[model samples]
Target: MTRNVARNRSPFSIWLAVISLCTAGLVGTYVLFVEAPPPRRIVIATGGKDGAYYRFAQLYANLLKSEGITLEVRSTQGSVENLKLLMDDDSDVRVAFVQTGIANSEQCDSLEALASLYREPLWIFYRGSKGIDRLTQLKQQRIAIGPEGSGTRGIALQLLKANGLGEKDDEFSALAGNLAAEALERGEIDVAFFVAGVDAKYVRKLLRDPEIHLAELTHAEAYERQFRFLSAVKIDEGLLDLQQNIPSHQIVLIAPAATLVAHRSLHPALVSLLLKVATKVHQQGDLLSNVGEFPSPKLTDLPLNPEAERYFRSGPPVLQRFMPFWLASMLDRLKIMIIPLIMLLMPLMRVAPPLVRWQTRRKIYLWYAELRRIDLRSIDGMTIEEADSSLEHLHRLEQQIARIGVPLSYMEEYYNLRLHLNLVRSRVLSILRGEAGHSQPGSHPGFRTEGGESTLAR
Candidate 1:
């Protein structure tokens, strides 16, 4: 019973050791395979309450929230300030809705566009009697160039200044979207400019009234020539209201596209997810946009992220669906570990049998050394009984070789070495018993004599 207990305990102990080893291996594998933690929440830098960016964020925030992602929409001074927030480390803001023409300076870095949400049309509305045929006409007039630090203000100031107008040329008022539109309607301002997306809610309400008239960019071609980034778009004469035929002629407008920009450090999976969401939110049939019309990764002030570039062309990875976001992240991290694993595992599977054969034949090889020694003793004319004792030692070694445990993969080579050991043992014994004369070690007698002399001398 005690023997039985000990035997049972031995296997248990071995199993425990195996379990411990496997557990350690599993833990190490998990450490290597485990994914990074997902981001807790994302902060989006949007424009002020009355602008298109803030309204767009409301929709995007809803879309991202549905994907288990929290979006903190922080109101800012529009594109320029949004870019600043993205650059500032303490802000923790990850994404921004920036109008394209705003970021003109060279100080920006580590930014990439996820997609172009919409075209931020530079809506220039003037009081009917101001007699403004071009942007230059607004010179020396009371003009509201949008709020300070706003995207509209930045682009408006730049465009008007190109036509030789600035704060000095006109009575510039820095006011919010609703406030500016209201001031223009009340005749408090001669002209008001809003660089916002198409059918801007506030601008539309003002345009519907008879008191305010929408200004057309008569010099759109010249504007596009001066600013290559600006595109000359024509708002059809009655496109806004086909039945009413509201405008008498086509309205030519110079506009900049709005870009969905993010920091370069954003995870590829997250970028892919954002891009996917942007596609669904912007490209799909929504109130303000049409199908196949949005989420363009092209209109950005900064360079495109490589993943965003690839995703724009090829789309998302398949493993992203089945794998957790964090796990998919790990595959990207350990991209280098794959080569070493393949190299090490291949030789282990292929050469294991050879390694076992080498080990099993080691004892048999040792006996060959002994047989050589006994053969030398016979060559030196040692007595038969003395040589027999060496033969007996070799026989014991042969028995020991047969008792060794080796897997069947190595059995052929093991048995072949055993056969060689037996044949050599018999040959040495026959010579020792004087049953056969001296057999040369090989074909060379001088080499054999020298080898035998050296063995006897040793």
Candidate 2:
């Protein structure tokens, strides 16, 4: 009885071991191949504290905080400095807002673009009465081209060089931002260059100042044709302050796109989250861009990241559409393991049932082989003592077979083996009754039928 109980428990134990091993293998696979969770904190290189880049970075910081990520905005001079920070190997800055044409493909091989946030128009505010309409007209006049390392200065030098101006000309000043605006108002400089968003306070203040005048780039399309990175935009009359009808006439402007760039190794989940934030913050229409025009894949100088491309083609990752941010991030990390795990299970699914079936029937087949051996021996002569011993052995085999546990699906085979056992037992009993005549101790026993043929004859 104890042996029977042990036999029944064997298969269950084997199956338990197999399942446990499979679970362990799957966990190991996940640990080895799946990506770790995204970092909880990241640093972004932004422009001056009061500039448009800094303001937008603050908004992104607030939005990311709700998703359990902390955004650290590091203040810098402008796009030129921001690009430098992103390229430095030891710097903590993972992302930055850079202006178009600041870094070319050769200079930014380690960077990729997420999206172009908006267009930054080059506003040339001057305090002059001679009606300066083109860049060439500012030849010998004192011009504030913004401080060094500022995007405003970079673009100003390029435009000034296109016209008949150079560094040798002593009239260029390094003033920028509010300082440039104050200098223009006080007549310290004849013209001041500003590359800022329409919503900047200083730009708005200068636009409404009666003493100041905004230069209309009458040849803006020509400039765009010359500089592929520049786009021709128009500031519609009175769009800045509709109530007071500021800028009473339409102003033609040429601008460069501002793109959000990151290191090539940045986490893909963070890229998706940043793209989502950019869409919310920059999708509204402004003086330089129509609604939904910004945060686009256009006007980028760097190669777009694959994750960002997927976001532009579809929306966020499919899992993120229905779940919270943290849960969705975990699931996204696990997605790479799903296919390999399914492949691992496929063969097991096909082979497990057959293995179990074989194990269940193995004991029954082993007993059947023993019964066949006893039947063959009974056909030959045996002493009476030996015949009684053989009968007892047959009874013992039957008791063993009866105790075995067979599942309902295999009952037919079980019953067939039992019938065969009974036939062998009857043959042994006939030998004991002298139905099979034994001539001598060493001779073979033969059983005669009604037709007088030997039953043991082949």
Candidate 3:
């Protein structure tokens, strides 16, 4: 009996599976193309662990960690190497700290600036007897301009070229950090160019050295004019160490802002979050910048990301301002798909009722096609052998229909179909008995066999 019912609904079940697959396919396509979730992990390229970029990146990492994101701060040579990592298509690095004016025109199309982080003052320390107030005063002296693929080297060359100095490899050295400081003390190098924060170790070492004098750059505003990325920042007297009375007097210096940058394909959610992080990390008052001044859009050379631009113009996302970052991001990613999902569901809702009705009635009405086929052929004047065969087919069909189970709502259809099938069976039996009324067919619903007083009907 169970096998008979399984045979009845087998076609309907196959159709159901096909429709289910099609529906699943549509939703999968929507998720894969229209509205996908952002990655939970991100990679950021920064300078060496001792540099300001890596330190700032760690602060950013801590804040992002609270939001369920893993920010990997990968240390590199410097901004030049960081930019290369971001530009490489196969590289997983998406975010990095880049100095203003470090990216060239050809590379500008692939990257975007989130915000200007902080001022990295260009500190030039020389071992000469008299303080060299201007860049042109030092001629053919050994200069430590940092290593290749370092932002310090890029900026040092630009500054040196601007001062009417030639770029000869023999004239310049790649020494940096302790090497540059030690070389200066041993007179191996006459000058060392460094772009770093006040907290950097090398910058601090040079500042405390009495023999190495800081070059008082003349025409600080003129350098800012020549390089759009440069800004004139003032160092107040004893700002680094007030207890030791360092700097002796206040002096103006040219500086470049370290900008937080990302590739063009980085997720917008991350960009918005990073903007919020920049506010918390760099908005506080520092030595060179007042409160809320460091992360400003000023002094940034790369084109601003759309999300970052909006964030600076307004504020953090409305959802993020009040709720937890993870929850807020989830809601934002789903908001776009809400309408599309509703649109996809509407068709399924409409077609479901008719499809269900067909499946239910199919369980009962299926016998009708076979019942009608047997009744049409079993007519008056048929041979006894044909009449017995037709009657046998009708009995088999009636047995098959009896085993089918349907919902309570469809029980009425089930019983009515049984009645039609019975009438057809009675006609075939009456024909087999050769009754008087067996000459003509009946007129009941789904019954078109002979109208005869059947022995079974009796």
Give each model's whole-structure lDDT. 0.70, 0.83, 0.81
State the lDDT of candidate 1 residue by residue for 1-458, as single tens digits: 00111111222343444455555655565577755555858888998876678887888778777667788889988888898888888779888988877765366667777777766667888887555668777777788886767888888888888889867647889875888888988889988888875576777677678878888767888877777556677776776666767555777788788888888777666887777777876776333346887777655666777888888788776656677555665576555456645554566546555554454555345446665666676667655456556666666766666665555666776687677767766666555434323444333221224544412211
Candidate 3 has what TM-score? 0.75
Model 1 lDDT-worst window of ten: 1-10
Candidate 2 clashes between residue pairs 3 or more apart in a chain or in different chains: none
**lDDT by residue for model 2 over 310-350, one digit each (tens)?**
99999888877788778999988888877867776677656
Q: Rank the candidates by lDDT, best first.
A: 2, 3, 1
Score residue 49 of candidate 2 by CA lDDT.
91
* TM-scores of the models, in the order given: 0.69, 0.79, 0.75
lDDT of 3 by residue, 1-458 (tens): 11266555643565576578656856675667555567899999998777788888999899999998999999998889988999999999999999887987565689988889889899999996797888887787888899887898989988888788877633888887778888998889999998888887777878887788899988899999999999899888998889988778998999988999899999998898998988899889578888988687778888889999998888898999999888888788767666756675677657767777888888787667776776677653556566666666667766777777788888999899889888887777666555424444432222344454323322
Model 2 scores what on Cα lDDT? 0.83
